[model samples]
Target: MWYQVFLWALFSSMFVHIIAALIAFCRLRKHKIGAAVAGLYRAADFEMMPFYALVWGVGQSIIVSFVSFTRILATL
Candidate 1:
């Protein structure tokens, strides 16, 4: 279950990141010089995706645990 949660969080964050990148790229592409500059920065940005995924997954796990604990408490 924890593994599944981790995968879900990772994939969801990645999906969101990709969509955001596409939007930013499209907007930046209007100017050749700007796009080139953004492309350079985006390379470094992409490299941090795994770190983003890890943080997102851990946050999600914490929320899930909190909710589960609350439910158990309510039942008692």
Candidate 2:
């Protein structure tokens, strides 16, 4: 059960990260920010942002999953 919760949280975080990145990219492009401003806001390369976000999100989800599993265990 803990493993399942962890896996679910990891995948959900990845999915959410992808969607958020896409939306952010679209908004950034739509506004036509200057190259310098874009560079300042997004220091990392465009191709790497999504991967970075996914990794960060997954890390956060791991903590969340652990906490949730502990809570469930405590209730029983």
| Most TM-score-accurate candidate | 2
What are the runs in model 2 whose C-alpha is more than 4 Å off?
34-76
> Model 2 clash tally?
0
For candidate 2, the per-residue lDDT at 7 reads 100
How many angstroms is residue 12 displaced in model 2 relative to the true structure, after the best TM-score fit?
Answer: 0.6
| Least well predicted 10-residue stretch by lDDT in candidate 2 | 29-38
Model 2 error, position 76 (Å)? 45
CA shift at 22, candidate 1, in angstroms?
A: 0.5
After TM-score superposition, the amount by which residue 66's alpha carbon in candidate 2 deviates from its true location, in angstroms, is: 26
Q: Residue by residue across 33-75, what tens digits does model 2's lDDT show?
A: 5656667667865555788989979999998999897896677
TM-score of each candidate? Answer: 0.41, 0.44
lDDT of each: 0.87, 0.83
Clashing pairs in 1: none
Where model 1 places Cα greater than 4 Å from the true spot, the runs are 31-76
Measure candidate 1: CA RMSD.
Answer: 12.2
